[model samples]
Target: MINVVIADDQTLVRAGFRSILDGEEDISVVAEAADGAEAVERAASERPDVVLMDIRMPGVDGLEATRRIAADPRLGDVRVVILTTFDLDEYVYSALRAGASGFLVKDTEPMELIHAVRVAARGDSLLAPAVTRRLIAEFVDRIKEPPPAPRLNSLTEREREVLAGVAAGLSNEELAERLVVSIATAKTHVSRVLTKLGARDRAQLVVIAYESGTVRPGWLS
Candidate 1:
């Protein structure tokens, strides 16, 4: 079963999420928290497979809580899906940088939210094409981009291609078709790229692909 923790300051939101998730046979709502600090604590204690974290919360806030959880070796199996009412670029960028595996607008459809948790649990990012375009637009000022990660140098040419495809929000199947290779080859390239770049998942790979100049706003579809 996919264990989940819902963290939001609003009581109604927590109840709503729990209600939706509890109906799924393969998923379980293991815990709920009203604040970021509590969310972090619950995550550490419950060790849920996925955390639906609110971007804005009292005390530490979701960004910091995500950072703490992501940084903890003990919680390495945990994946955080940032839940927020705002679709601001800053929030999207910050959440990913803070180690969020995915981001969802608070009003996301119930099924989408459920699917997001499953995607994150499988170590895949929930990136949509529109989301990728907006993300790249927000960081187009490449001059002020983050410092280059040395690990980026470790990627082979094919891996770099895979990284760019990932930043473009292509799934493994799409990537395979684009490269004219088998899906297994595409998956292998993605795995190698993640390892070489030291990225936790495709979300971080997207970040590095942009920051390293492998992908750009103008190039996005």
Candidate 2:
């Protein structure tokens, strides 16, 4: 089963998510927290596979909670997915940097929400291509000079292309089409890039791509 923890300050919000997620046979809402501190505590104790976290909470807030969870070696398997009212919420990038696997809008369709939980449970990021490009580009624009990514030097030319494609928000299938290779080959390339970068998932890879200047804002556009 895919264990999940719903963390939102509002009671109704948590209940709503629990209701939607509990309906899934493969998913279980193991715990619920009304604030970030409680969320972190629950994460440390429950060790849920996925955390549906709200950005704005009474105390430690989702970003800090995600950072705490990401920093904890014991919770390495835990993935935090931020819940926000807006897709482009200013704090979303910060949350991602703090090790959140992804973000979901509060009004996301029930089916999409379920799918996101499943994706996170499978250790994949829930970054839709168009939204990811726009979001990452917006944040990258503010960085006058991104720090160099020395680790990128270890990647092969093809691996670099795969990284760029990932930062551009291309799925494996799309990447295969773009590179004129089989989908399995595209997956292999992405896996190699991830291994080299030591990224936890594609979401962190996107952050590394932007922060390291491997893929710049508007370059894909």
Candidate 3:
């Protein structure tokens, strides 16, 4: 089962999420918290497979809580999915950088919310294909220039190419077609790239791709 902890300051929101998730046989609502500090405590104690964290909260805030949970090696398997009412790019980027596996708009459909949790639990990034380009564009708009390149000495040329495609929001299937390889091979390449780069997940790979200039905004469109 995919164990989860719901962390939101609003009582209604937590209840609503619990109601939606409890209906799923494969998922369980292991705990709930009303604030960021409580969320962090619950994470340390319950160590749920996934954390549904609200970005805005009283005291500590979800961002900080996510950072704390992510930084702790003991909670390495615990993934966080940021919940926000707003789709601000800054929040999205910050959450991802802070090690959130994914995020969802608060009004996301019940099924999508469930899917996101499952995706996080499965160790895949929650960034949907349709939003990937938009996310990269927003990152570009926010930064005047690319940051310094990350140390990519360990990557093979094919791995670098695969990394670029991932930054472009290409799914494993799409990447397979683009590289004329089987989907499993593409996925393996992606996995290898992530391992070499020390990325927490695909979202961080996207961030590194942009920051390291492996993929640039102008390269799109």
Q: Which candidate gets the maximum TM-score versus the true structure?
A: 1
lDDT of each: 0.86, 0.90, 0.86
Instruction: Report the C-alpha lDDT of model 3 over 52-114, residue by residue, as the tens digit.
Output: 999889889999999999889899889999898867557767888888887888999999999
Sort every candidate by lDDT, greatest first.
2, 3, 1
TM-score of 3: 0.92
Q: Per-residue alpha-carbon lDDT of model 2 for 26-67, expressed as tens digits?
A: 999999999999999999999999999999999789889989
> Can you list the residue pairs that collide in candidate 2?
none
Which run of 10 residues does model 2 get worst, by summed lDDT?
127-136
| Per-residue accuracy of model 1 over 68-113 as CA lDDT, tens digit each | 9989989988999988786765776777977888788889899988
Candidate 1 achieves a global lDDT of 0.86
What lDDT score goes with residue 27 in model 1? 96
Reference-based TM-score, model 1:
0.94
| Candidate 3 pairs with clashing backbones | none
Error of 1 at 167 (Å): 0.5
Task: List where candidate 2 sits over 4 angstroms from the true fold.
Answer: none
